[model samples]
Target: MIPERVLLTLDLPDEQASNQLGEDIAAALRIADVLLLSGDLGMGKSTLARAIIRAMAGNPELEVPSPTFTLVQAYPTRVPIQHYDLYRLGAPDELEELGFSEAIRDGAVLVEWPERAAEDMPKDAVRLSLSEKGQGRTVSIDAPVDFAERLQRSLLIRRFLDDAGWQHASRNFLVGDASTRAYESVCRSDGTAMILMNAPRRPDGPPIRDGKPYSRIAHLAESVTPFVAIAKVLRDAGFAAPQIPAADLDNGLLLVENLGTQGVLDAHGIPIAERYIASAELLARMHMHQWPQRIEIAPDAVHVVPAYDRVAMAIEIELLTDWYLPYVTGTPTGDEDRAEFAHVWEQMFDLLDDAEKTLVLRDYHSPNIIWREDRRGDDRVGIIDFQDAVIGPAAYDVASLAMDARVTISPELEAAAVDAYCATRARLGVFDREQFETAYAIMAAQRNTKIIGIFVRLDQRDGKPAYLKHLPRIREYLSRALAHPRLAPLVPIYRKAGIL
Candidate 1:
């Protein structure tokens, strides 16, 4: 009874197989009070009707002789079963004479050749048809809401305005995360239901006069198949992620299973104390997912395509040297200071290459992690904002969560979460405590430096002045990470660049 579900053609090479399938359908629809069957001759129309009357209603021995000659057959069932073949009837009067309307009102009525007497058919009855396709037969059932009265209707019909492409049916649309490019809806048709996705071909972003390096938002789903693959793996592992109902692989239109109205940060009243535990569990699971050696994505195959590699990282760092310093101290990077930054970044990038790589969530923090009301057993955290996942240091995600740029976690809670993550990793035989803590420090330091640059760029280049308010917190995390012995050398270069 799930609408919008597409039924594959039903076919059997021999008569015996066809008879068995017919019996199955009959037994399945036995409880129905009214049934109407319509199909071409020699397409096994009467064969299916016979199977239902025999297998269902405990009438295995009842004789189901063809009603074609008599036009009607009555059987004694818990609910009277009336079979009518209307192929010969030219109008409603022929069927009305057999008391077909009264039969349906009395009990279950299975009517064959309904097209002959369509006008006389009961208002509340399931309509079925069979059509030959290639070498098989396709069966379609239309159980109107009035017939079953069990349909799940939409709360609002106006939402269909968004999915105007389907004129015959309506789809349910629900709001999604701001980062989401596609809208989700569920559509019901022919007694089968399917999730639908509505995405505009054109997206709104900065004006592209000539498409030359202006900031813009574009559909980048194709560039990150690994992220989607990992989402599938997580969902398979019984974690809660946005359900992908339908995907237009070519256009990035995805119908997703709706996650209801609640985000972790929005639902919780308490601060880091209660939330950190849930965040820790999800991060631990993400890090544990196996990283494939070779990744296939559009970006990977593009020739001479730019990646967010060392060169990109260096350009990003300069935003701090260029804009952030000016924002905070009203001073600019001098020639000598720029030289020091170049030297320090080169060394930092070199040192980072030696660190082991894993599947990193890139932006695994408060903004992306949603909490579940119940925390025990399975993960209560829902991780979102993961379009930028990458194979990088394990510390990348850990640092993003612990020293979050958007939300602050107290030192005590941060230590506890780190311990929990490390413990979980050790249980999985991935890494030991000594190795994890050391790598964590280096990654944390690197993340803080990048965030400082990002905050500055947002203020000067993007005109997002509100981010400047968090500069004090960013500076705090940077200072704390710099205190580590591993980042001692890097701190002096940042200090010379006025970052410290």
Candidate 2:
């Protein structure tokens, strides 16, 4: 379902007049679930955003900075706003690379000059248009389909005006529920407003399975309890963790404090290497934390990757052998290669069994970490996507980061990070440092192999060719891991497949 619809035509006398119009827009925004400002140059798009921000906080000095060059800017407010300028975008694929999806989750996003980014935006987004009309200005607003009733009932609008010491302006404005089930709007009788979100729910990703089994697993309540408990344990240890304010355990509905962007993977921009090291240090910290007796794995607890079992592993391998191999090279895999590949997988499994295991973030890569400037020390890394966390080999997460299945980390940076992580482990009381390194190498090789196969599948089966773009980098990581003596034995198999 999409949001409500509201169309408003505003006439402004001049650039300065846009501020008062902005104030009205801000007032309208209090009730509106999301506000979209669209206009051309000299049309005062930024001015309108500033006024709304000012009106929301009733603080005239609040800066509504333009995100034109930065791509996006997130304001710190009781109800935060995310501003985006997509005029300079070179391509739609750039959205994922720039991390726009994650930003939308944390706060309301406003985009200026959005024509180029139309393809990258939400399908049912609220749209607005601004144009220069001689000395005056004209503004047009279009709400998402069917959002009228909800917008009119929006709690934020009712509370905002009340807080500003005003009576309930008619409840005539249209509104809708927060974009996702995780977010809920709450406004008092006054105009004071804030959005409450359920922290337990992670963003919905590509469906990993089909039918009822996956359907049951996708719901927040079924999936979030374990991770919430895990975060509580981390929080007790003085780490920054997701806070769960309220939840119906059976239903999965929740109200949570918005933590803002502070995840490790969310770190970006120049000095990228420095941000990576910081994330590495935080992972090391989590790895070194002594597992408390209270947290025990239930025998029936589901595996993070449901398909990680023996049968699933075989199916994945078959997908590589039968589908990926032929499609990529038009050369069918021989029976002999299949036998050797299975044997190699078995050997890798044995090595995994032998390694000293620890808590592992099953998917520890970019797009999960939130970056915040105010955070102190290692706590700056706001880790998310831990619902699938597992108690597995210490090297699993390290491998997940080093041979990232998503973004590539340069060899030099990866080496420095591994060293840094190992050093942190030593400081945090993990002995047998050499064993950890060896385990790390073995896991790196194993993880990258699976990723290489998966990338091929993403392209061939899922029709996502973008993954192909990163295969060479994954190969590079595999080459580096193979260089380590511990993984030297497996290099030949990969080389045979032309994966090197």
Candidate 3:
């Protein structure tokens, strides 16, 4: 029996608006999902499909030819997509010959003339019917349960934009990271752009310690409050954090300034030395400030930034055993090993407790650092992704930058950045190079250990295997840090776990 569908109708005023709707639908598509486009010839079915394919491919000029002759056209993207036209199909059974089942196995499928397939079409497919309406078109969508939810969310975003006086703006989906948040570039009719941050309030995961989720224990932000609060603080301090023009804190949505696309990385994906140095200087400047542990979000509202204390650090490092050890060794962590791991980490945390504390933007790596060439001094490096910011040891962020997990930092460049940062601190007042380097080594080891488990968890628990490719690089970083005399205590523990 066919299930009842949740229908949504939109009156697209022009081809531009129809393309925007296509982009919106494309952003919601997941792998293995099917979009069945049902419309008469020249009823804008191919036009809509092209928009979706182009948006997903991240190339506006991508050539997406009609699949009427070829039957199917596949595009390699972050989420692979296959566009199919069944207008020339000889029979419904011919789909099997054309590898229809295999085509949607690891990617999305957009089928035009879906009626030609009749009962062969999956019941879960999202069906879109377009009809001519004067000079434009009207689209009616019959969405499955999952697609219905996405449609509702998309409608909410449109309403929010309308309320914010950007009703005619076009939205292009921006690539997202491993977080639950997503982003979109909203371009106005005047060609100006703003970034839309779609961060829903994160629900607490299953309690891992003391009836608290890992997010709480790790001091991860639960909503947009931390981001809004921290961005305001950074901007007020003359740093280049985005300006929030409109926000729906209750719904966890925000429209902020679009920090240009120029990043700290070069075309070859290597970090630019000058940009990294500027980033280090920005960190030094940020460290020089006396940041409040609590900030006023509004007249009566307040946000208290959590401290990255022993418990938080311990929870983070525990990922090493909880995920990575089992993944690499193919055995669950035994009780005895767990006890030894805890003891070693406890000792390490004791050493970290005495280090100088500052507002540590937990992730201060290349991916999060934007290079604004038009800006000067500290402002030239625009900072983002600080919702997980915490009051922690200053060396934590410095190490995060120097031993960047996503990108390789050469030894020469790493030394130069460390020296530049220490020099800046020295000019400010008192700086102990040896003590800071020791702290840097400890933080690097700790951070890399956490990352090893994180990458494994992302592959096992989240079904994202791409992160596993960086495991070797992270292991190298961990090895380098553990070689430091201060981190020797961890060497035996890692060796015993067979992770060395």
Q: Write one digit per residue (lDDT tens) for candidate 2, span 299-417.
A: 34322322133333344445556655676678898999888877876665666555666666666776556566687876677665565555667777877876666676778878877
Alpha carbon lDDT at 288, candidate 2: 66
TM-score of each: 0.54, 0.54, 0.93
For all candidates in order, the CA lDDT equals 0.60, 0.61, 0.87
lDDT of 3 by residue, 326-439 (tens): 998898999999899999878888887678889999999988898999988877899999999999899999889988899998888888888889999988878777878878
Instruction: Arrange candidates, best TM-score first.
Output: 3, 2, 1
- Stretches off by above 4 angstroms in model 1 are 1-227, 248-253, 260-270, 293-312, 374-378, 497-499
User: Against the true structure, whose lDDT is highest?
Assistant: 3
Cα RMSD, model 3: 2.2
Instruction: Evaluate model 1: give its TM-score.
Output: 0.54
Q: What is the total number of backbone clashes in candidate 2?
A: 31
Error of 2 at 130 (Å): 26
Which scores better on lDDT, 2 or 3?
A: 3
Model 3 alpha-carbon miss at residue 184, Å: 2.3
